[model samples]
Target: MELLSAVPFVGGALGAIVPFLVVLGIVVFVHEYGHYIVGRWCGIDAEVFSVGFGPKLVGWTDRRGTHWQIAALPLGGYVRFVGDMDPASAGKADDGDLTPEQRKHAFHNARLWRRAATVAAGPMFNFILSFVIFAALALAVGRASNAPVIGELRPELAGQVDLRPGDRILAVAGQPVETFGEIIAAFVRANGAEVEVEVERDGEKLAVPVSYRLASRIDYVNPGMPASRAGLVAGDVIVAIDGQPVASFYDLQLVTAAKPAGQEIVIDVTRDGELMTFRFMPDMVERPHPVTGETQPLPTIGIRAIGLGGIDPTLEPRGLGEALESGFAQTTRIVTGTINYVGDLIFANADPGQLGGPIRIAQISGEKAEEGLMSFVYLIAIISTSIGLLNLFPIPVLDGGHLMFYAAEALRGRPVGNAAIRVGTMIGLSLVLLLMVFATYNDLARL
Candidate 1:
């Protein structure tokens, strides 16, 4: 009902809400269930198995004495075990008051291996859910994307480069490129250099020479500006402005911003590997900023840049296993590439604005969802995989952290001291918070 009210004009609001809620609920339920089932198998009694996190909304106790409930917060859920000093703690307080039989069933009293397995199940379940969902989607719809072979080349750059349309990009400089997106990203970050691009053509690898050009001053259109009227898209690599070489999108923007209204400029762009020239006179537009409510002048661009094709749709569709394998492989490559980019940013090899958070996720999710259900599902799969991997990071308060502790305990024949866990938890929490803040700042800056 609330979902219907949220989108009154859309007749399928209920339908959409149902699927969204079902998917989210299922993921949370499975994760908690993993903990509960493993704990029970380890002879520990689960006091409660709850879906969601805040105040309890509705629940019931089973004959086995496990309270099953749905909480108010839908973000995450948890399972509480008997004699758990803290819901998530690995150590227990003195249980002298408890009967010997009850004490035997305490979570902390369980074997170290059992306790480790219980903690590890939550994240394992998350990954299992992701893999299953990804595999199913791939099997049902088949992954969609263009091949990495060059389909078109910009005329301006083509004149200076020897690359051809059929060439399959293998690597940029010395780094291997697994996808077209990765290739473009690497190209942009390289700036101006005599880059060596390795390509495969006619079964032979060839190195192509390319140069990166750094733009002078770049100007971003404010909330309301004449540039917006002429049409502009983010990521549009502007090559020329007013018959002058612009080098980068920023250069074109700076030149236009300095010119007054009613001055027409010729803009040359390499959109989707095609060279096109456009003439536009910017008109100033005004809009209230969402955060400050202050009126601002932003450039208006009516058209957006279209990306070049890379995915090959002609490949024969495969079965579930094959599809799943390919999906996993592709996801792994993407994750690795992203990690490399993060390192690049840290070392000042990449721009920090490429980082984004919830705002960007929502923007992308909304846009992909609008494209179709399949596209939306693909986005979800990518997000799910990313989340699964992130949770596996060896940071305290994460599944991987518990596993690390388990390993230490296994080797030392004793649990790590509480002081160590506390310190690690603090460190992990601080790192996560810092990352969130940085991502949020980047999101706002882009706006």
Candidate 2:
């Protein structure tokens, strides 16, 4: 693996494609299995359960006569049930010689509710998988405590400050702080200057003067972005931009924004106690506002701060219930945020160019994997949630579309006409294909 990184294109492709396949395969399998299991419970016999499309690479028939297979393509998967015309199960099979007993297990012959439930199960399982992953991650990492306590100081702060882990911060400068937010606000007010911090350490209160402007230290480097392309990495503290000293992350942001787009700028950073300089042109792109979901053109070097006031938060022990609750909230937030973004895009309030495809996802997966296992897992949870929510959109050729047909059947006392279903499916397929093409174009443009 180390040697592979020395190769030009081969190294990057391997790094990205492997992680991408792993994430996609797991998500697709979970989704398809959802349909398979639910269809089985509904007395429907699955003829084939596949984790991909195209030619079969490997397969085995189970005792129930269901062929479980992995296919050549890894993009998506499907469950072909009995009485399905094809793998997509878009239509019923015309097998005249089928026994009545066999017909009873046919998916198309199943009750309307059963079919709907089976279709809905795919997206449902995706959401559940995301929730489980998020909850597990929270349990593993623990949650940040509410108090303004020091968990661990940044390594750069070593010897410069006497703050220790488990120390409860009482005040910054002269302002007393009761919560973590207050502590951050106090530091921000200090404007990156050295301030006296009062802390309760080992049952004794002590005042320690410390510089609270470590937010300039990069916590994340966005893959394929200006900073990453220029060889900037996390833990590198950006000290100056274009010869102007930057004392905080906010200052760095200001300098970047003030610089003209596409203009080459010099960035001085300190990494492992050594100063280094990098020159790069910042990208001007339409990015979604963090709070509003509205698009605005912004100049960014693509570095991120992981925490407020440069504090490495101490993780507080979390119970199972709390972890699950946090997971639910996180999943809910992503769903709503995505919905808002889609709505904005449709209304021309958001940037459609920001829509990404497989390539972008692969790049992100590779970058996060390089960061750490937990970061990669977190990305998986996010992508899983997105996939689940997307499948729920009421469009043809999706889980939502099938549900729409079921609703019509329930309302009209019969299934929608075959002709109408075929047309809808065609339109849905076209839309899906167009979307993929457009998103891929965007990905290439980014590159």
Top model number, TM-score:
2
lDDT of 1: 0.59
| Residue runs of model 1 more than 4 Å from their true location after superposition | 1-27, 97-102, 143-315, 341-352
List where candidate 2 sits over 4 angstroms from the true fold: 1-12, 159-162, 202-205, 216-218, 221-247, 251-304
- Give a tens-digit lDDT track for model 1, residues 187-220: 5556566789999998999998877543432223
Question: Model 2, range 292-341, lDDT digits (tens) per residue?
Answer: 33567767767888654446667777899999998998788678756765
Could you tell me how far off, in angstroms, the CA of residue 195 lies in candidate 1 after the best superposition?
A: 32
In terms of lDDT, model 2 sits at 0.76
Q: Give the per-residue Cα lDDT of candidate 2 at 261.
A: 55
TM-score of 1: 0.56
